[model samples]
Target: MSNVVNFLTAGVFGGTTLLALKSGVGCGLSGLRRRETLFLAFVYALTALIIGAIAGSIPVNATEQVVGLGVVMHLIIGLALVYFGIRTKKAWLSDRKDISRRTFLLMSLPCPACLAATFLSCLVFTSTTGVSGVAAGGVIGGVFFAGIAGGGAATSWITRKAGMDNPSTLGNVMLFLGLFYLLCLLLVPAYLQAQDAPAFGIATDPSGMLLALVLMTALIVFGALADRIRHTAERGGR
Candidate 1:
């Protein structure tokens, strides 16, 4: 049960964040003219998460070494990701070739985060269980994020290919809701397993989970209401 919880939480936190961040780019590029900031927040949240996970993984003999190394590594990795993301976007625009599903998947690979998450999670998990358990945990975290990033890239490509005429705000709203729901599902189990740990802390048990569900539900509802209001206003021309 504990293992199941851990894996699920890792997946939720890892995967949803990836999707949110990718989608957030669309929102920002859209000039926030009407884009959902929820999606953008999701992106920011996801990036911070992977950063935390990877930084947590650094093996250090001293406290200062740990802090210094984690900071430097994160900076380097963040820059590389931004560079590649830009390049990928450019490639899509320049070639005018539809981003092949395969290409998107290939591009979605989270270079440093995947490796860093695995390494860091492995170290943390290993102390709890054994080397084998840590290895498995690392694999799970890496695969989850990789799949997420890939899926987001694919979705973005498909959305671009589909091309909307008016560009509905609902698209971004749905993107945020979908990612949030998935993340919530993933974390529920993890929160359950970790509930008993003194230092570890489950982070969220039944009440917390319920609260999250309610909050996410509210977000979805609010987003939908906003969309309706916008559409009505546009039709009214004032």
Candidate 2:
């Protein structure tokens, strides 16, 4: 029961939770149909579960292989985020209509953050719960899906209330989140290496935690200031 609770908590507020929230906000800001938004959310959650189940099924002896793969996947994702951030900024500034809700939703489907989180969660669930195979996968996936869907819904609501439907605002949010995810991709692996800890372990490096907190705080502050400046300029122009 405690294990279940922990898995659910991680799903809601874990590092990957940010990805889910970002997807939700993107969906809302893109003016996607209500049904489309819900469909995307469901698909994302289901994908995470399926991936988690597959990861959990891997033999314990192959831990190193899994970690290596995860690292590679994250590296690719980090680079992709950097590219996407630059492109999004350009598009936003140019008032380009190149980006679409379908594209954004598709991209969010295989989020590296979600994949990593699911992988780790599956390992934890298998090890701690002594539940393996399809049944364990189903449980882990269901809980994770619930947590992500719930978080996404909550974030979508908040973003709507904050007038994040504006293209500029949405672009900034996406750029900010992209950078944040990139930072996580870089820092998390280094932290794990430094601690000589298993990727799925609960052990945390204090320095890594502090650095992440500091960086995230700075990103939030910078985003807020940028938004204020943009809004002010718009008002002045009007």
Candidate 3:
């Protein structure tokens, strides 16, 4: 039950899941066909699975090294998110064109948060359940990714139903969400480290997790508010 909870939580809040939501909104706004949207979602899931399998193969003895590498990777992802946000904002202000499907698909592939979540889910499950081996890891990975896909599909459906299919609106939302996601990637690890929590896998410190979640939510709100203010100022200037 704990493992199930962890898997579900990770999938819901993972960066990849967020990316999927963005993808869905972008697809709806861009007038992408249903087949194309599904194809992109499938690509995300497949990439996550591959990342999970590779991360799981790391030996337990190398756990410290993995954590260090994860921190570095998270930093890199954070920067990528910032760059993406800036680009999206620029595109919105200039051409107002929708992002390309190819670019979206590629971005989904390297989602560090999703990769970390899936890897940690597998690690925690195996550690707790006495399930050791590549096969067990693969099963856990599948389960984690299944949750991600479900969340992605649900968000996409909701956005489509809500008629949020405008390119400029979608672009603005993506830019803000990207910044929020970047904040999460950069801060969560540092928070855990400060708490002296477990080096890898899920931190046992509930307070730390709660704090991270709260901070992430706050970041999202901040991003949204900032975007609103910027738009208001622009309109006033005009």
Candidate 4:
């Protein structure tokens, strides 16, 4: 595929990642004024462009080295996230703080999945076409900006309309996203390696797919439960 297409695909997937989705959902619930959310969304999208440009500068041969280093860096971040998740589960379960600017920061961090998409896009672009690094980076940045910003805008609107805004929602999103990231980076990768498969393997393998399904189901359930709890509290107050 062409670099542009690769970037578009990666950008879409990157925006839909658990981290990105949480960023969107959390932003909607963050209690920021609509204008603030808009500004943050734009800034976050700009971050994608910067990251893409940096990623584009690396020679294609360092793919393996980059992947290894990425995994290590992600592991450390994943662990930190998991620790915070555990620490805050109780508050989230009970009082639930509503405002969180942290989601934006967390989402801004280059998670393993997002990095994978970036490198993969770079690889494709470099091999298939002769675009300059700057050109390729611009394309990647533009596409990613569109995906992230568009998704954020949609979520922010839906949240305002549906009244799903909650103080704790953003923190809760961070916890869930961290759990998902840890699961993918720590557990799934080891298992995939043991099975003589590639990391991030989500092909026709029923086992892999089933596990992913379970994880996704958990996220869905968590969102539903949180919303229900908020509604219940509202009714109780009434």
Which candidate ranks first by lDDT, i.e. highest?
A: 2
Higher-scoring candidate on TM-score, 3 or 4 = 4
| lDDT string, candidate 4, 132-203, tens digits | 545555665555555545556777687668775554445555566666766666466657666877644533
Question: Where's the lowest-lDDT run of ten residues in candidate 1?
Answer: 98-107
Per-residue CA lDDT of model 2 for 115-143, tens digit only, reads 66566666665666566645545665455
TM-score of each: 0.36, 0.64, 0.58, 0.59
- RMSD per candidate (Å) reads 12.3, 6.1, 6.7, 6.8
TM-score of 1: 0.36
Task: Give lDDT tens digits, candidate 1, residues 24-110.
Answer: 334432323222344434443355345444544555654345434544544454334333333343344445433222222212334
Stronger candidate by lDDT (2 vs 4) = 2
Candidate 1: which stretches are off by over 4 Å? 1-118, 121-174, 177-182, 185-199, 203-205
Candidate 3 worst ten-residue window by lDDT:
101-110
Let me know the TM-score candidate 4 reaches against the reference structure. 0.59
Kindly report which residue stretches of model 2 are placed more than 4 angstroms away from their true locations once superposed.
Answer: 1-19, 52-56, 96-103, 193-238
In candidate 3 the C-alpha lDDT for residue 18 amounts to 48
lDDT comparing candidate 1 with the true structure: 0.45
